[model samples]
Target: MAYVGTFSPNHSLLFSGTKHSLQYPASTRRGVVVVVRAESMTTEKLGIKIEKNPPEEKLTQLGVRKWPKWGCPPSNFPWTYEAKETCYLLEGKVKVTPSGSDESVEIGAGDLVVFPKGMSCTWDVSVGVDKHYNFE
Candidate 1:
């Protein structure tokens, strides 16, 4: 069976067939692992989570089409999220760099992105943006 999960610095979790293994340092308490059988997996960059080209069914489940749309031309600005935000990009490209972080997360058309609550970041919109966004 296929599994989808993410890795942290202290633990390594791997799955094959029906068996799974967790390898962690001795000092830390055991952590929980959540796995999903998905056609696509999510990835993290610059503390932001992104699911590239997520399955169509997943979009439907999120009711992405019903979310409010926001757009902007090429510009750079700092933003802080008071609540968790999830957005589906319908067009354009953006690079978001978290506060004090040099690395940036690049997101574009067809990407599902999640920004954690209280996150402070800079948004550099390079190709304009047309997206449906929801705050949770």
Candidate 2:
């Protein structure tokens, strides 16, 4: 005797090096990160797997990158992404410019910022900078 269910093939385990343990929702009996493939409940039939195929837009799992700048730095122009990002300042200060906004964010050590996904922004780290980030 056995039973079957549905699951998402892809899901964020952890944003960065941050470890995580999965908990079954009240409605769920028990589960794993991935589950057995079933035919009866196709994506449409089960209202799951909404995206047949999504673009591959993967970045570093857990990464730390240092950015330096010259006096009166112009800006740190990077590509906009669809994943929410949090930055931890290790040194220096930076001005984070989010898309659709005129004001920018200035953050320093022990300071964290949650950047909304799909934000177009620039980084202006005064006195150079070092930072650690977690993105899914």
Q: Estimated TM-score per prediction?
A: 0.70, 0.41
**Residue 40 local lDDT, model 1:** 64
Lowest summed-lDDT stretch of 10 residues in model 1? Answer: 1-10
Best by lDDT: 1
lDDT of each: 0.84, 0.45
lDDT for model 1: 0.84
lDDT of 1 by residue, 11-124 (tens): 555454444445555454245555766466699876689998788889999999999999999999999999999999999999999999988999999899999999999999
Query: Quick one: how many clashes does candidate 1 have?
Result: 0
Kindly list the per-residue Cα lDDT of model 2 for residues 67-99, writing each as its tens digit: 221233334665475787655545566676665
Native-to-model Cα distance after best TM-score fit, residue 76 in candidate 2, in Å: 3.5
Best by TM-score: 1
Which lDDT value does model 1 have at 110? 83
